[model samples]
Target: MKFIDSAGVEFNCPVTFTGTVTTTPSSPATASYMVKRWVSPTITQADLTGGQASQSVNLTGFPGGVVLAASYLQTTATSSSSNGGTTGATLSLGISGSTQAYLATGANVLGAAARLSNAAGTLLGTYRASDVPQVTITATGGSPDLAHLTLSCRAVVYYLEVTAES
Candidate 1:
């Protein structure tokens, strides 16, 4: 069987059947059934500025049967000044209303990409269709005039449908 959305988008569904069938005055056979449904990866991206409050990416209203699978964060563009200070700028990622990722950037220049995942190779938390993820960037510490800094962010998220057994 196939599943289609209002937009006429088709979803991938692989099914298998195993059950018991009996014939009149005959032997009975056992069988089982299973259906595997899946959706393509769904991605979401957002740009955020440095030295500002946390920015959020809302994945609300996404089609059902899709859950957050994985995510990535990178700095697309950035500008920073020493402001005659010692400390440099920083960037971070985290779930909304939770602790920021331990991974952080350093110095005025943009740091390396921050891969967001746990030791188990999973994202920090379970995110449903209508979840919001957040990102934060710390301004260069120094004189306002000299410490001016800005950063653009791009976040990509992958979504997949939950298995029937699960």
Candidate 2:
């Protein structure tokens, strides 16, 4: 069997078992069966624009029963000389209705880059079947002096569906 995901990634399920059996009867009936299944990883990305106090990305159509294996946020900032003597910015990622999963503060100087992930700090474990994962980005303690800043967020999800056989 072959499985395809929303990203068009293809995965082949190799049959692990094959067998034939016959039922006892005057005239015996025979049946053949094969079993094949696998788990595949899927990834989706959401881009966020900076300079705003708060930004949110809605992960609509996110499959249920799938695990939110991992997630991370990357950000880039370009500050002009005019930003001199201004405080740096602190960025954080969190669920729409939950506390921050990770936080990164940019350098006070111009042209600074920052990357943050929940991997070691506060891991966002597998999501619940009834949970809708909405990632939110919040920027605080930054001076409006910054020329431009941009943020991009990405999420990796894993899931597998089992086929029932009888």
Candidate 1 segments whose C-alpha is farther than 4 A from its true place: 1-66, 99-129, 140-147, 163-166
lDDT of each: 0.41, 0.39
Model 2 lowest lDDT segment of ten = 35-44
lDDT of 1 by residue, 31-105 (tens): 332222222222222243334433433333333444555554555544434344424444444456643532233
- TM-score, structure 2 vs. true: 0.40
The per-candidate count of clashes, in order, stands at 6, 0
Candidate 1 lDDT score at position 79: 43
Question: Which ranges in model 2 have alpha carbons more than 4 Å from their true place?
Answer: 1-52, 74-93, 99-115, 119-123, 142-148, 158-166
